[model samples]
Target: MNLTVVGLGLIGGSLAKDLRSKGIAKHIIGVDKNPDHCNKAKELGIIDEFQPLDKAVANADLVIVSVPVNATLKVLTMVLDLIDDKTVVMDVGSTKSEICKVVENHPRRKNYVANHPIAGTEYSGPVAAIEGLYDKKTTIICDQDKSDPKAVLLIKVLHEAIGMHVIHMEAEEHDRHIAYVSHLSHVISYVLGKTVLEIEKDETNIFELAGSGFASTARLAKSNPDMWTPIFMQNKKSLLKAVDEYQKNLQEFRDLIAGDDEKALYNEIGRINDIRRVLEGLALKRAQGN
Candidate 1:
């Protein structure tokens, strides 16, 4: 297969590496606005060659776009305009609803598949690309009914090739769910990091005193703001709802502690501990895939 990846950053570059390593694609073409990423990706053998957007789309049997959410709609529309019916276009963006709406009425909408690969590191650029990034990860294919069956099938096959389990969902639901599970995590981490940094101004050894738990909780704070800002903007309504719920929980916990309601606090923590069961099940499913 002739596969073209439009953004040669972490996700796109990693996909190219896996597709080539697994012999899924005969040729991998990359398109990126950043010359450094293009050169780095080609030098690392992540892609066979670099081509302009139109030229790449014209020659690709499959086009995988992994750009930031803000640029996704524009790049998707441009690629859709350039692709033939046989070309299957899929985007791996964080938020799905707005992008789906952007091309809802497009003539070539059937050729496009919208999905989110629930995987990545707190890193960017071609240099950050790694193998097995999608292995055992869950991929959410949104609004599959809007896409052509052949295109959707091709996407499912591609995801399976990289060892991803597929789930179908409406774009709105995907956005809402991810707002809590994904975006909210980032928001919390960023705030946590900001809070620490603010304190570090007065306490010089604040970071030095940090433990593994703090590092893990603050890790997502290191993610690219350029990528995250657009996602938060696109999923603002759902994200706001998630934030409100989180704040309510935080306030309740604070009141419990202030009132010395030890039993209530213990019960709340115990209730939250139920997530361990859900996560353990997901981990088992992923391990079975391996």
Candidate 2:
């Protein structure tokens, strides 16, 4: 396969490395606005070479877009514009509803596949990318019916080739569900980190007393804002609703504590413990996947 990856950051760089390692792509080309990133990608041997966006995608068999969600809207259109009819395109953007809508009426709409690889770390850039990032990770294919069957199958095969579990869902539904699980968790981590940092400015003992639980929960705060800000903005409609729901739950817990309602708090906490079962199920799946 001749593949072109548009953004040479963690996701794009990782994909390039993995495809090459897996022998899925015979020649891999990269495109990025950052020459430094391109240079780093070459130094790391993540991509064969870097080319201009138009030239890189011109004769490729497939183009994998891994830019930020906001940039994805424009980049995807631009990629579709450059590719020939046989080329298949996929974007690994976080949000999908708006992205799917942007090219809904394009002549090459059927050539594009809307996908989100549910994987990453609180890091960015080519230097942070690693092979096997997608191993056992879940990748969602949204609006599968809209894409050409061949394109959809090709994307599915590619994901499977890279050791990803595939799922299909409507783009809007994918956005709504992801807002609660992925976006809301990032917001919580960012806020939790912010809250502690604000307090730490006055009381430096905060980190000294912090434990692993805090570290784990706040880890996503270290994620690149350039990538996440666009995600939060593009998915604002669904994210806002998720935030409101989270706030309601937070207020309930606060009220319970303030009211000295120990019994109610105990019951509420116990009820929420059911999430442990769900988590355990995910753990079992991960173990089995390995």
Candidate 3:
């Protein structure tokens, strides 16, 4: 298959590199509005060549759109007119409902498979691409029933070949779950970073004191704002709900600390400990390929 990867950022560049490394595509072409990304993707051998969007989609058997959530609709709109019946188009945007809705009535809707791969690091751009990033990750396919069987199967096969576990869900359900698990975490991390930076204004070496727990919790703060801002905006309702719940939890903790309520603090800490145990189990299950 000849694959064309749009955007050529962390996800797109990584996908292109993996496809070539695994011999999954006969030729891989990349498209990016950023000339620097185009040059870097080629220099790093992430793509066989870089071409204009029209030419790349014209020749590709598969097209992967891995741009920002806001930019996805515009890019898809531009390419929907050019995709052939045999070409399978898939996007890896963070939010799905809006993008799915935009392309729902298109004649080529059947050729487009909407997917969200549940894996990434707090990095961006072609330079951040890494191998094995998608291995053992859960890939959520929304509204699979609405997509053409052939296109769906092709995408399922492609993700599975790269060691991803495929699961299907409604777009609304995917958005809700991700708002809590993914989007909320990023928000917390960003706020935590801001909070710490505020206190560290005079303590230049405070970051040096940060250990594993702080590092783990604040890791998402390094994510690209350009990419994430649109996602937070697109999924505003769900994300706002998550943020409200998070604020309530934080307020409860603050009250416990303020009142020096030992029992309440202990109980709250125990509840969070249970969450740690659940995450540990998930990590183990993923490791064992359960």
Candidate 2 regions exceeding 4 Å error are none
**Which candidate number maximizes lDDT?**
1
The models' CA-based lDDT, in order, is: 0.94, 0.93, 0.91
lDDT of 1 by residue, 1-290 (tens): 99999999999888888888888889999999999988999999899899999898887999999999999989999999998888999999999999999999999999999999999999999999999999999899999999999889989988899999999999999999999999999999999999999999999987788899999999999999879999999999999999999999899999999999999999999999999998898899899994
The lDDT-based order of candidates, best leading, equals: 1, 2, 3
Q: Which regions of candidate 3 are displaced past 4 Å? A: none
- Candidate 3 vs. true structure, TM-score: 0.97
Candidate with the larger TM-score of 1 and 3: 1
Give per-residue CA lDDT, model 3, range 19-85, as digits (tens).
7778898898999999999999999989889999999999789999999999999998777788889
What is the lDDT for 190 in model 2? 97
Backbone clashes per model, in order?
0, 0, 0
Better of 2 and 3 by TM-score: 2
TM-score of each: 0.98, 0.98, 0.97
Residue pairs clashing, model 2: none
